[model samples]
Target: MAETDKFAVQPHADATSQQQAHSLEHWRSHTGRNDIITGLRAMHVWLALGWHDIRQRYRRSVLGPFWFTLTTLVMVGVLGFMYSELLGQEISDYLPYLGIGMVVWQFISTAANEGCNAMIGAGSTIKQIRMPLTTHVCRMVWRNLVILLHSLPVVVLLMVFFGHSLTLEFLLLVPGLLILMLNAVWSGIVFGILCARYRDVMPIIGNLFQVGFFLTPVMWRASDLKERAWIADINPFNHLIEIIRAPILGTPIMLEPWLWSLALIFLGFAAAHYLMVRFRERVAYWL
Candidate 1:
């Protein structure tokens, strides 16, 4: 009886120590010091994963990655020309607008769609090891960015072909890209957690993105909307695109759009942070 009692107590004691160690490690990882290290580590992992994703996407294809560039150029060219003619606008100016808008929209749409599955997609890894959840989100962002970079050549070609003068204002796209990336991080955290809990969210988000694509001023100019210009004002995506488009066109970033984006950024980060904190422990089980 004494020996059995001792054995039971020893197992409980060992279990307690293991739990304490796990709790300590979790807290350490959450602290700023560990977060910084984790962030840097995540960046490296993300880059490698992004490259793998890009390669796998076009593996064995004759055209390879260039297919992404070619498809984008052809689609943008055909849509821009068709829309310009239908809207009775000059092809030269409208083509650039269409090209930039489509490229930016591609980033936004990809973030929204893929972001929902960031965590769930990594279920096996999450179960096998202890890794920072943010790493998966960062991977999604990096992968999308790889696609964005591939499409950039089209933007340059459009500028050259349309005879648009590149100015210092075009540098605004640097900040614009930053904003989009921040948005991607926020979306990845929020949607990734949510969809991990509720699998149905993935399909719902996909449908919403399809609807958002047409609603956004991707293939058309804001000016063409005319009386319905308020649509652009209400759509956060429009502001996001404008952050890139206005500067590229030598137009100033409107104060309202910047204000709206700032507000969304703040709100998005706050929401994601809260969700991550509250649900971090349950994520693996949910997945």
Candidate 2:
């Protein structure tokens, strides 16, 4: 009788363990499927919000949306001339480099700064509606991309005036831009979620970026820092800028920097995805 009771208790415990394993697997599958569907639905809403944001941004301006293009041109012209003299390079060669770096930096900075507040900026909408939190972050990225698009004409004009002959290599910009945009999306998601939870993050990020401007090779060429060449190698932004600028300037893309940038981008995306999944529900409350 004692042996039979022990055998019975053993099977009961085994059965309970099996049941728990099944329950956990089911929960994982259900959550995974929900996140996918939610992300797809959120993408659609993001598109609409992006358009609305662009319109709203330009609604009251006298020159309207063209102001983006105008301002970018003015800033690029001023900086290109100043940096060309400082770097002791011909205006023709140096201006293209400056223009490309400045243009890419604008996009990166806009994404980072705005991404920090993406969720908080949409607080009214988040509060009033039932929507996926990712939508707000995606919308912020899309809106900044639209602004970047508007500023492309300035790039074209600068290239026309200061660039070497155009080549098929220019097509490389497509992939480079895509990668940069993906990085933006990932960064936005991570910063948006974190900043929502920690309000103090915004000011800190702003100050850091201000300092980053000096450290990055925007106005100066990497060649100028012969002793500190490691700085460009370590700075992900430097790699990203080079990926776009090299091909446009008809130079071969350096493999090391490109590979490093890809690794950083992959890591960024993976981390953001994990955070988004883990804190999916809590984001609403944080906002």
Candidate 3:
């Protein structure tokens, strides 16, 4: 009788263990989705945090954030003329193009470079608070966006100086900007999580962006590539840059860049979502 009872109890214990394992897996998956949704819904939290960052960065300064605008103006003026001469492109044509490209590239590159520190920088908060991890990533992206707004004056000045008239096609910037921000968000989440886990990854990401700056057509034109235009065509950054730059310059916007950006948006978010699901809980411990 005792032997038979022991065998029966063993099977019951095994069943309970399996059920608990399944429950744990389900909670992890649910928590992942909840983290993102909750972070997005708590925009008030991240918005205030983002705004605070911008203000703190320029606190007590006379020009405040406009200093960023002045720097961008200087870059556009100097690099625009220098690259124009080096590449033999007409100054009238090149200045506005470089202006918009530099503004857009500044936004993209800064968002990505700072994204590597998003989670790691928030290590103290993550350890003490139970809020969604995505909030930190959102805050970093928003802070950069505020800086981008300050830099828009540079774009406005370019349009006026170059005598470029706005057309109905300028509305294209609406969708282009939306796509760019979405990409920034996902890329930040992925980079933030990875950088928090592995300290070395941040430098590698920085180096890649540095190399990308030259390879990308920020100071030069894709048309300069001439017969080898396909080189620029294949670069993802080229497509991303052209989406906004072309509209600003009043050049014909192509369908190819729109399609490529949409694809990148989808693929990037999918990767970010998977990483969030798998590693969301691990992030706090990693920090």
Best by lDDT: 3
Task: Give candidate 3's error at residue 89 in angstroms.
Answer: 1.7
Ranking by TM-score: 3, 1, 2
lDDT of each model, Cα atoms only?
0.82, 0.78, 0.85
Give per-model TM-scores: 0.85, 0.83, 0.87
lDDT of 3 by residue, 7-60 (tens): 999999999999979855643344776777667666888999999998899999
lDDT digits (tens) for residues 1-287 of candidate 1? 99999998998999999997986586345732243236435566778887888788888999777777788889888998899999898988888888888888988888888899899899998788777777788888988887887787578678777888877887888887888888888888889999999999999999998999888888876777899988877989999888888888777667887787778889998888788668877889997
Give the winner by TM-score: 3
Q: Candidate 3 versus the native: TM-score?
A: 0.87
After superposing all C-alphas onto the true structure, candidate 2 shows an RMSD in angstroms of 11.6
Please give the lDDT score for candidate 2: 0.78
Work out how many backbone clashes candidate 1 has. 0
Over 1-287, each residue of candidate 2 has an lDDT whose tens digit, in order, gives: 99999998998999999997985564344442254245435565689989998888888888766787787778888887887787788888877777778878888888999999988898887677656566677788788888887776567667787546777878888888888777887788788889999999999888988888888898887778999878876888888888888877888767876787789788987877788678866767887
Model 1 TM-score, 2 decimals: 0.85
Model 3 CA lDDT for position 41: 63
Question: Model 2: which residue pairs collide?
Answer: none
lDDT ranking, best first: 3, 1, 2
